[model samples]
Target: MAGLIDKAKNYVAEKVANMPMPVATVTDVDLKGVGIEGINYGAKVSVDNPYTHSIPICEISYTLKSADRVIATGTIPDPGSLVGKDKTILDVPVKVPHSVLVSLARDIGSDWDIDYELHIGLTIDLPVVGNFTIPLSTKGEIKLPTLSDLWSKNPPQSSV
Candidate 1:
């Protein structure tokens, strides 16, 4: 009897281990907009669902780091759900305050860009398995908007 129960447990474990799971990746990160609070950047995430049913996304948490310092971090709760048996693209936004930019002046001054690493946690509710978290990370450089670029967008009015 003991041997039979042990074999059953082993079979269940093997089945779970071989189950198909969702896959995710960070496609790109770019400047989204500028506001009074500071600069807003968006990270594009692509997730592929293997199941034939839509999965509910519980939350998306992110951390933005520059020059080995954590510049920004936040979480988006109940973002939405992923498409069934298809790829879903999500835009995760991170805001860096003006003061934080000033603190990173040394790194930004060198090449007029910020070298960053973005870490994201995508949580999804899978059928029967409950919640599963897919960890993603990417590193790249983001160019800062120069004075000329800003001026070009909103030219200064000539004083009469």
Candidate 2:
């Protein structure tokens, strides 16, 4: 009886290990907006679901780091579901306070850009398999808006 149970467990494990799962990658990270609080950046994730049915996304947690310091970190719970048998694009937003930018002046001043690493945890509920987390990470440089670029957008109106 013990041998029979062990064989069953091994078979199940092998099936689960061979099952196709969702794959995700970070496409891009760019500046989204600027506000009094600071700057808003967004990370675009592309998830390719192999199953024929939609998967419920449990949560999306992210950490933004620069110069070995954490700039932003947060979790988005129950964001939504991934499209089945298709590619789904997800937007993850991160807000950095003005103080944090000020602290990283040394790195930013060099090339007028911020070098960052974004870490993401995408948790999805798979049928029969329970919850699974897909870890993703990407590193890149984001150019800061120049003074001229800002001025061009909101140009000062000459007093009439």
Candidate 2 steric clashes: 0
**Per-residue lDDT of candidate 1, residues 1-160 (tens digit):** 9999999999988988888999999987877767899988888999999989999999999999999999999999999999999999999999999899999999988988888988999999987678989999998888777677565664222110
Compared with the true structure, all predictions reach lDDT values of 0.88, 0.87
Q: List the residue pairs that clash in candidate 1.
A: none
Q: Pick the candidate with the highest TM-score.
A: 2
Worst 10 residues of 2 by lDDT: 151-160
Residue 4 alpha-carbon offset, candidate 2, angstroms: 1.2
Residue ranges of candidate 1 with Cα displaced over 4 Å:
151-160
Instruction: Please give the TM-score that candidate 1 achieves against the real structure.
Output: 0.90
Per-residue lDDT for 1-160 in model 2, tens only? 9999999999999999999999999887877767789888888899999998899999999998999999999999999999989999999998989899999999999987788888999999998799999999988877777667565664222110
